[model samples]
Target: MSSSSPHLWSPVRWAENGSVRLAFDQLTEQRDGEPLLLATGLGVNRLWVPDGLCRMLAAQGFAVARYDQRDGGESTHLPPTTTRNPITALFAKRGEAYTAEDMADDAAAVMDALEWHSAHLLGISLGGAVAQRVALRHPDRVRTLTSMAAVPGDATGLRTMRYIRLRTLAKFARLKFPDTPEGAVAAGIAASRLLASPNRPLDEQAVREAAERNVDSGVHDQQAQSRQIGAQWHGPPISAIARPTLVLHGEDDPLIKPGAGKAIASRVRGARLVLLPGVGHELPERAWHAVTTEIREHATSAHHPPAPPAR
Candidate 1:
């Protein structure tokens, strides 16, 4: 096992109920520093994220933690009633339900379990939406926020004409992922080619290994994916959020257009928006260096804001 892997952070029970048990993994030596929670995107296996990225974030000097959101890979899966038909429960006032709010609570519950009064919040795609909700719902617990490649909410509509290239879609559709880890690794390589940056050649072997590791942890649940989409669909508007925020999005994201990012940055007062040219929905390996640098600077500067100008 690698020294900086979230595996070494060890799993701690984050929350539980009659249905599921959620947990978070630590990726650094100190849990007491400004805690940075890394929430994965929709339908993404928590382990699917490259270990090197997590390690680099931890090594950047924040106490890093990551976790499987409820019903995602390696997290407790819910019953068919909820996971399969999440839309029905969107407005239902009930316990043990999974909405975007509930998902944000799951992240906050992890924070609560850690006894962290507040921490840096960062997320990807759908997780980026979750980060916004976290700052909205549990504002006290979020010291700073970094939302990447996600829309604010339904308030900002995606353009009607946006669509992925058919060749790219065909490549993904043709990918036949096997049940075994080896085949999953191959599948990852295929998907990487489909979603990778147009500016660089895909790293076939590294993505394959990352895919295999994620497969070893667990397969992504289609039903859970249903719940995650429902949550994003019914999520609250975030225009009024007052947290110090960094909004990063690919200039050419076809799934959720760059306008969504612009809308979000416009909504959140003082949000810094960084447009990655020649990028897309996927956070390719090449983007990590710039992505992480912005996050590190954003979080660190939150601690040392400039003095008030002469009054």
Candidate 2:
């Protein structure tokens, strides 16, 4: 497969899910590869998923599509509410915007728009939690589940705090950037650097390019991040996910602890867990091969199960 141009993606498509409209785009044109839908984290848009990573997956025979969640990217941004900070929102008693179910439905809406009846789900950070919820609410629509750098879907309020690093959160809360487009790019680069593994060098050029692609990267939109973090899940927990599941966590992740991956793997029956060393919250180029390989193998195994031994 040839390397795909970062700017040469399918035109942005709209998926209408109830009151919200989601923005998404197809990164690959492979009809034979398994359909893979990516859900990004927090306030970041679909561009946050590195183009190189998507290209690598496409080369591995996966048709990839990524989308912006309700309050992020080009998606419908709801009227601003009282929630102003992600930390406060995490502890809020109730969601001031939408429920977690609505967010999961957004993923299904994207899949519907792509004409895919079912697809492998790959989500990172907040996206990871959303993916877990999608599998629980719409099991038939998810062929397999992959959650990376994410907490458990059902964990909420104080319970969710156990897997987070408060110091890292503090640092994120301290991040301040101007509201201009240039500031948005700076904020994105800074945030990416913060999430990058300390042991490896981050490719600032890739981050700058991605940020430049979306001037309104949403990294500074604390309100939207708050609403996303505050959205509560009332549906079944990760324990109820019946689809083949894979949990990946960075051992050196500064934002979310590796235990989050363990929790998801432990709850989901027969789920596989892979902890990557020298990896932080972000998917650097160094870790792309491992991540793609794992996802490819996971999807293939789910499709071709081992033959049962003769009795």
Candidate 3:
């Protein structure tokens, strides 16, 4: 693949529970390898991951797949829930009618479409939260679980973080997505700058391209973002997940802090935790190798059990 060109992903759609549809792309380089399904972050699409990283995972003997969540990319559009405004919803955490469990069903539907009976599920941020629900609600179908930069249910840690509040205020203070193409790119660039690792330089072009592709794909509206935010689950605690679980996070994450990751790892029985000291909310290129290594090792260990202890 050329560095100047992005991977051409042809997204096909799958409907779930008669209400939601998701757009997904898959690479089957390792046709029978453990199917690894990725759920992206909130208000974000699969394009958020660099195409190179996706290809790298595919090359490493894994059938890699990623999909847009319900409200982002070319997937289904859910109307704005008007019971509360965005500010109050963010602060008060109200008005969301759906939970990540619903989103996980969409994931199961996608897997059904692909005829994959079970998969190694991995997610980032909000995607990570959804992945947790998938494990909880459909434990038999999840081979292994990897959650990155995600908080547990209710996002209690995030709501308590001062930086999150400040960041929210700053973004809404001057938020605007211009109607033109250039404006869209600009909007993406700004968000990338804000979300990128504080320890690393920004990848402006990648962000710009992702934004442009998302715009071309379909509408990425504020309502969808708000709805997803409102979709935070208030159900059972995270301690009940029985899958081989890995929790990874950036210690410097401003959006969902390292504390959130730690909280999750503590709750899930035998869940492994990895914290990158110099990383942030968004996965930097530098952290991809670490992230992939954790995932590979976790899944491989799960599949290849240790020898018997008897002598």
Tens digits of per-residue lDDT, candidate 1, 61-97, equal 7787777788776678766654343233233344234
Query: Which lDDT values do the candidates have, in the order given?
Result: 0.67, 0.89, 0.72
Task: Give the range where candidate 3 is weakest over 10 consecutive residues by summed lDDT.
Answer: 1-10
Ranking by lDDT: 2, 3, 1
The best candidate in terms of TM-score: 2
Q: Is candidate 1 or candidate 3 better by lDDT?
A: 3
Taking the tens digit of each residue's C-alpha lDDT, what string does model 3 give over 196-275?
66767666676666666654322224567767766656556678888999999888776676777888899899899999
Residue-level lDDT of model 2, residues 1-311, one tens digit each, is 01236465788889999889999989745746889999998998777777788888998899999899999989999888898999999999989899999999999999999999999999999999999999999999999999999999999999999999999899999998888888988888788788888787777787677667667648889988998998999998789999999999999999999999999999999999999999999887778999999999999999898799999
Cα error, candidate 3, residue 303 (Å): 1.8
RMSD of 2: 2.4
Instruction: Count steric clashes of candidate 2.
Output: 0
What is the TM-score of each predicted model, taking all chains together?
0.80, 0.95, 0.86
Clashing pairs in 3: none
CA RMSD per model (angstroms): 4.4, 2.4, 3.4
- Model 3 spans with C-alpha error above 4 angstroms: 1-11, 83-87, 91-97, 154-165, 203-220, 232-234, 305-311
The CA lDDT at 157 in model 2 is: 97
